[model samples]
Target: MHKQIIFNLPVKDLEKSKAFFTAVGFTFSQKFSNDQAAFMHIVGDDIRAMLMTETFFNSLINKPVVNAKEGNEVIICLSCESRAEVDSLIAKATAAGARIPHPPEDHGFMYDQGFEDLDGHLWNLVWAETGV
Candidate 1:
């Protein structure tokens, strides 16, 4: 059984990407970070993301990298404890140069807000309480 999971995404600038995510309330593990890639910690579990440069990422895969700004490649969704947390994270991301792709969604029990990171990666912040 696998105990940990990691997702890889490409970024043009490692320093800039790290700064952006840091301002948006995310942390990184310097042990896995290098000139070619950075390991971003998702905060709770062993789930981490490797932010690799396009050149390095290409070396690992045999396909053309997609321009995330033109079209989204994936939407990374995160669950928050409350609606305030969802709103706060989105606000922080936006303040850190992320764009709000759309308006926040309120489904009574579940609330969602999202933004596109500096590298144009889509991230959805969702909040839902028990017995809401």
Candidate 2:
């Protein structure tokens, strides 16, 4: 069975992407990070993201990269402990130059909100009852 997962994404500016995610309350692993790429730690060491420069990312994939700002590629959804946490992350991301793509949603047992990062990646923050 697989024990770890990492999502590789292309970024125009590594430093800016790092800063945006940092402001959104995420930490990075310096051990796997350098000039061309940043190791963004999402859920400890088990699940993470590699924010790479356009040149570097292009070399890893054979097809052309999608412009996230212009079209939909993938939506990264994260589970939050509570609705407050979801809202807080959205607010922080907005303050860090992220664009709020949609309004918050409430469905009795679940709450959701989302923001677009500096590189136009759509990240959804969701809070749901654990027992449900």
In lDDT terms, how accurate is model 1? 0.90
Q: If candidate 1 were superposed on the true structure by all CA atoms, what would the RMSD be?
A: 1.4
Which one is best on TM-score? 2
lDDT by residue for model 2 (1-132), tens:
998889999999999999999998899989999999999988777889999999999998899988889997799999999999998999899999999988999998999999999888999999999888
Highest lDDT against the true fold, candidate: 2
The parts of candidate 1 lying over 4 Å away from their true place are none
Model 1 residue 131 CA deviation in Å: 6.6
* C-alpha RMSD values across all candidates: 1.4, 0.8
Q: Write model 1 residue lDDT over 1-132, tens digit each, in one string.
A: 997779999898989999999998778888889999999888566788999998999899889888899997679998898899998998899899999989999999899999998889899999886876
Q: How much is the lDDT of residue 44 in candidate 2?
A: 79
TM-score of each: 0.94, 0.97
| Alpha-carbon lDDT of model 2 | 0.92
Clashing pairs in 2: none
Backbone clash pairs for candidate 1 read: none
